[model samples]
Target: MAEKLESIELALFERLIDVGKLLERRADRATREHTGIKYTQYEVLIRLRNAGGEIRMTELANKLVSTPSALTYQVSQLEKAALVERVVAPGDDRGVLARITPAGRQLLREVSQAQNDMIRDAAVAPLDREQVEAAYAALGALQRHLRGEETGGILPDQAPPEDTH
Candidate 1:
């Protein structure tokens, strides 16, 4: 006789989709509050900040997973805000090196802190330490995988245990 699956397991796919949407929603809400910058812009800014110096337009585009034209547009906006600036690359007159300005650093710091605070507060809510740690670990790993990194690989049995009792 086939055992009937519980409601939770029966709706596994739906639950996965719901969780994904909820995560995105939370991220969107937080980013909007910190700055009007979208996640894409934030990512570009973060990359420049991480570089600790200027980056060529092509490289920035690659890091942002965007095209040259799109990167140019975002860079233009950031330039207007004095968040980023462009300069000539040494030995390459045609190359434009984009760098984050002091004001941009300040803005990034503020936004980063706010995002962190939000996550820290949430970690203290509803979920226990183990759940929070697992979530954080999973998110980081997934992010890396999506970026085309060489992953350590996930196993079928290593998935989060479903509540069935």
Candidate 2:
């Protein structure tokens, strides 16, 4: 007798979601313990740093997967903590950009170093270097596919449309 078929799609997606939640929880706890900032705030600061310390609120909110209102609240919290400030965009007084202060950079450096230290102290050995590199390449390709980049028609099950609605 064969085993009865079930919801394989649900199983796969649920497993992936569960793993993501676990990873996020661990990161949040670790970052909060060492940097006094939640993972989301740390991610915001890191993105700002990568953007050369200034980015429009709309762009930041999109990257954060948050709404403008919610992002404003977060920015206000950061501003109150003296870690970030709003500045007028050059040539556009109406446009506001978030700029990390000198103090914010110092804090980001401290927080990043601490996180790196924690990761290193985990004592986990890297997988095969060649395999890891290949995996990264594959992931980049997969990310492109997932992000709606395709040359030919993709199967519905292979690539679901992104929900921007």
Query: Which candidate comes out best when scored by lDDT?
Result: 1
Candidate 2 residue pairs that clash? none
Per-residue lDDT for 89-157 in model 2, tens only? Answer: 889989999887777777865766667665444312355668657755665675577654322122223
Model 1: per-residue Cα lDDT over 62-99, one tens digit each: 77678999999989988888878898988999988998
Off by over 4 Å in 1: 1-25, 120-165
TM per model?
A: 0.62, 0.71
Give me candidate 1's TM-score against the actual structure: 0.62
What C-alpha lDDT values do all the predictions have?
0.71, 0.70
| Cand. 2 TM to true fold | 0.71
Worst 10 residues of 1 by lDDT: 156-165
Residue 47 CA displacement from its true place in model 2, Å: 0.2
